[model samples]
Target: MPTLFSKYAYYFNQLCEFSPNRLQAQKAKNVAPVRYPTPVQKNMNLMVDFKVENKVIGYSLASKQHAHGNCLVHFQSTINRILKPDSFVVPRETVAISICNSFFTLGSSPTDFVKTKQGGKPLPEDSYFTYKMVTKHVMIVLYNSEGAEEQLAGFVYYPQLLTSRRVCPNIDETAMALARITYSSDNGPEMFARFCKKTQRDVIVKIMNGGMSATHMDYNYILLEQNYGSCSECNAFHQEKMKKEKKEKKKSITEKAASKSKSKSEAATATETANSTVTPPPKTAPPKAVDSDDEYDFGN
Candidate 1:
């Protein structure tokens, strides 16, 4: 049996062969390789072949050098012919290949990977969290053999991470409170209903506005539930955030020095003002000389 690594490598090589430049080069030499509508391969017991539909999809080239061409291949597993169809499970290799195919089909750029929109918000740039989330979703879709569009349709308005009922436990209560406070007329009941709905929508939008970062935490929580190990992505994100916070919070040496100098100058000015405001004791100079002469005459 071919190892998972071998399978990925095989598919990647197959994709490269279908590159437009390579095809054109072959044609120019009058030695074009045979092409198949569905490329199939056989495996021994407990094995199933994947029939991949290959095509070249046009995308904005990330660089001028890539203007030559790019290939997009979609792999569909045909498990109907598996020796043990009832017991067979889709391999992780299939999921990995699907991700790779989707990536290349879109474009070879960070922006291409970020085109997916979650909760009406465009996904941020690629990261470990995003990569794992994408992989998990793809795995689910493949395992169920469901249309990716149907499985991902919910994410159009809300993220999969927030699918649980408990994520926003107070949403209804908060909406109700807002509605009651805003509408206190004779048609209060009807107005309350409308207001509540609007409030709920607004809350969801607000959550999604900050959802990207929150979702990272949620993803890690889910992973923790499954196993005791900590998420490396979450750890790395936290460490990076700490680094940024420290940098922002730290005072520069120049600022400290300036503050010290200002304080010293103010102290000196205060001391001078205090000294000038005081009255020295009145002079007793002439009285002392006269008192000595007067005391001598009285004694005589």
Candidate 2:
């Protein structure tokens, strides 16, 4: 019997040799599509195709590879290398929380059984999304439960799938359901918001309390959030301090000018007083001396 690694190696070889027809034909013969209708898109049924080596062992979805995460791509690229071919596979259980425009599915398979009957009437025009519109984003995370601890299986994200929930007024419940998926765990927009709150609060609290020892902070966790950079209290405090400094500076300048003016006035007043008090030289002293000389000359 070929091991799972051997089978994956064969698949990779097949991928390199790339024949669309051969791959599809092989898949069609070896795999069967299960009738699983996704809640987001009623028209499109979710299909699971399992790989067989003498018997069913592994399952995968034929999904387009994305730069972000995609479970199918990761499963083909990495997960198959680790798991035993004979280990029973199951989907991970996901908690439902309200997240706008997104939803999560446990495992590669869906649990709810929505049936299709033969000769069924066509669904109403409003029952699904139109061909032109796209609405929902999906994140598929896979886990290997065969081990003592559940290990990460693979990661996949689907962006902009059109659904009736997004298009019409009727699928409110569907939209609500997808929104109910928890955003705390995944590193999506919601998780980023959470990160922003945590980091912002920590940084603000530290700075306000005068803890500046941590010069280099891990700010990669920052993306976007409300009241992050523009903290109201911080802004107000700084503004008040700046205003106080400006007022003190102005006061000092005014006081210096007043003192200078007073000193100049006092010097001018002293100069005027000295000039007014100066008496003319005693004019009579010379006349008296001349009179005395004349009297002495007569006597001689």
Number of clashing residue pairs in every model?
0, 9
* Candidate 2 local distance difference test against the native: 0.31
Model 1 spans > 4 angstroms off: 1-226, 230-232, 252-258, 276-281, 288-300
Best by lDDT: 2
Residues 1-300, model 1: lDDT tens digits: 469887677556644533323322322112221211111111011123322222212112111121111101111122223123432332322311222222222233211221334468543343211111111111111111123221111010011121232232122122222322232232321212111131121111111123232112111121111112233444344456556756765756667889999999999999999999999998775744457676678655
lDDT of 2 by residue, 1-300 (tens): 479887677556544433323322322112322223233332123323423222222222223321222222332332244334533332221111111111222232322111122266642332211110112322222221232322122222232122211111111122111222221233232111111233332222113334212111222211211122444454444456557878999999999999999999999999999999998986554534456676677655
RMSD of 2: 29.1
Worst 10 residues of 1 by lDDT: 150-159
lDDT of predicted model 1: 0.27
